[model samples]
Target: MFFSKLVMAALAATVLAEKTPVTPLLLANFERYAAFASAAYSSDCANPPFNSTVVRYINDVPTDTQATLFRDDIAQQFIISFRGTSDIQDFVTDLDQVLVPCVAQGIQCPTCLCWQGYLIQYNAVANTVKSAIDAGLLQYPGYSLVVTGHSMGGALASLAAASLDGQGLPLIAYTYGQPRTGNQAYANLIDSAFNGTMYRLTHTNDGVPQIPAQSDGYRHHSREYWQSDDPPTIENTFQCQGQEPSDCNQSEPGYGIGNGGIGINAAHLSYFGISTGNPLDPNAAC
Candidate 1:
């Protein structure tokens, strides 16, 4: 009985040691991203059918950071997209003049066509993230920074992650339904630079990530990809039908899919509270 009681005490201690406290810096980062979403959704460039849809999409997706009290303390930081300000004619002219040629002759050039527009938008978001970091809004020095997005947002997150990595920052990025941004060499470089920080999530039937340049060297992370058949729950179903959602089934014990792994539940929108199984130890620096 003493031995069993001791084992139980040890387990309790382990659990207590693992609990993470929510920090103000983390809360600031969440608010910063929220502002980014609000601004992106409100942008005039977020036009027509997409504008409304994007707004709702941003609103519906959850963040792990919101569960903490820090949510109320951070100052709001709003970002205005250049695309939102540019008239359609000017936007097209800029795209034709600046972005199109970047991917024109590449191996993934054909597939990159659609991403051209998204790249421009991502640059804006990256700038926003950088600005926040620079201003000391997000002050954690050792925390792992992850940039993520779903569908087009995933592409944007990829670019943002790459941009941050280039600046000699330590960060990781996981994109869902992300298109191929560049050639294999480029993708390889991104993977290496980010220390394999890039993880792509896909739903089996979701066609967005299948665009050109995606299949070459891109590595996917998910439980369904390797495990036996598990029926999708209403909570876990991908919005797009017929696609197998690449939720992070392989995440370590602390980071559960519902908590922090990638899937429809783990997409850029829902990352804040996804348990990640590895709950942050409150005693540790936030």
Candidate 2:
């Protein structure tokens, strides 16, 4: 009985120790790390700072799915960074926004209809991650896992984070310019699952975050961190209530699809300090 009690105590302590807290410094590093992983989808970057730490890369092709696993022995951390939509099929997947029953294993799940394409793609990427994580557990016994991505990749990261959370793994996720992933039910489920561990960031007038349209019963995760068009600074941000608010992404009028050509393009591409160009027209959406 004494031995069993000691074992239980040890297990409890391990669980408590696994939860990694999010800080400003950590978020800044993760945002850059996620960008580097996202770029790997488009370019062959040479001698990137994160290249040395990539223990595994999951690229499930003839589809736009890619992820990188960075294991830092010095910090004892394991991070899974997902790549965003890269091609026509990916954009087609995003626009094919039909929500069907989120059923699995012969049972009807609460949420009706997840994004069919994204869900299919996310599962493929997640299968690879699951196998990698299982092996990583044996290799790096107490390492914490952090997941991050941008745009469509961010949506997939959210799904992956929630699914992994089910296995009792402590989750820390950071996603930028993420669109609404699912219906209200799906959002509710994931929000509660990742409650404090997820930080979903949306820059000013980012139309991507304003979609897959809340009018269709789609919703965002709670406590969204809204960065401003003014300038990138920690002081120039706001954590909006629930999903939409006057001060966040929904602040602008119209469908939030953006107005002019520059506006539409700028809204989607400017997150993480990657600028498309300054508008020839001063009034272009920021």
Candidate 3:
């Protein structure tokens, strides 16, 4: 009987040792939405700009079928707190000039001020991360907190990442077509703080990341592209090179673009429905 009890204890210990880290789960959840946004952008390339009412619906009406589905289906996957906010339109309007070509081609435009809202939203998210950490979410030391979003959401994700990094939180953020939120210095600081924890997913020739830098110092990450015909998978084709932790190389492939380039039309839209890669496959390397 003593031997059997010892065997049971060993098995329990083994099970505990084998548990998956929460950090990866959080990162995976972020990547999942990025993949979804990629698909959504591709499918809706021809849709019109988001009107004010549509934006309102997305932000205010949590009970709306689509919003609820997005929250229930996606947000719950990780311990994420989502705050839907307006001002995505303002970002689009601000970058109206450089985004014209992509906008005309039906690619979505990523907005600048939308990132501002994200910064606001991140204050809450940052607190959550702090609370989680204080509560011992990182007791395993391998657990990670993640934040993700699609299109404008992606842009916001980047901002949140920066804020979290400032607070010295361990976070991994995956954003799709996240536009340029600030100057080169800002991007560099974020990259340095987050290290390999930030991944930006972009498709071939997508224009959202191509925003004209306000200064010569502004430089975005180097992108890894997924072939248009490839299936969505977490492979080296989907990672981008940011400004820090030189050895942090990883990849994944997927669809989506946040609108931004040369015009008002491309403003305030999220790309959907394109084929690329799965952001959450454990077997895949990126």
Backbone collisions counted per model: 33, 3, 39
- Model 1 Cα lDDT, one tens digit per residue, 28-126: 343333333223322232332112212111211111010111111122221211111113432352232122422321123232232456554544344
* Stretches of model 1 off by over 4 angstroms after superposition: 1-114, 213-286
TM-score winner between candidates 1 and 3: 3
lDDT of 2 by residue, 1-286 (tens): 9999999999876643433333577446545554543543433334433433666778888666877676766657777767676667777888778887654322234654577777877877776887897789778889888887777778777777877776667868888778788777777776677666788877777677777666676777775777765555555555655645444666655544221111234666655454321224211111
lDDT of each: 0.35, 0.65, 0.38
Q: Write down the lDDT that model 1 would get.
A: 0.35
Worst 10 residues of 1 by lDDT: 60-69
Tens-place lDDT per residue, model 3, 60-146, is 222211111111222222222222222444344334333111111111223222233334433434444445444544343444455
Using lDDT, give the best candidate's number: 2
In candidate 2 the C-alpha lDDT for residue 256 amounts to 48
- Better model by TM-score: candidate 2 vs candidate 3: 2
Candidate 2 clashes between residue pairs 3 or more apart in a chain or in different chains? 99-113, 100-113, 101-113
Residue 183 Cα positional deviation in candidate 1, in Å, after optimal superposition: 2.2
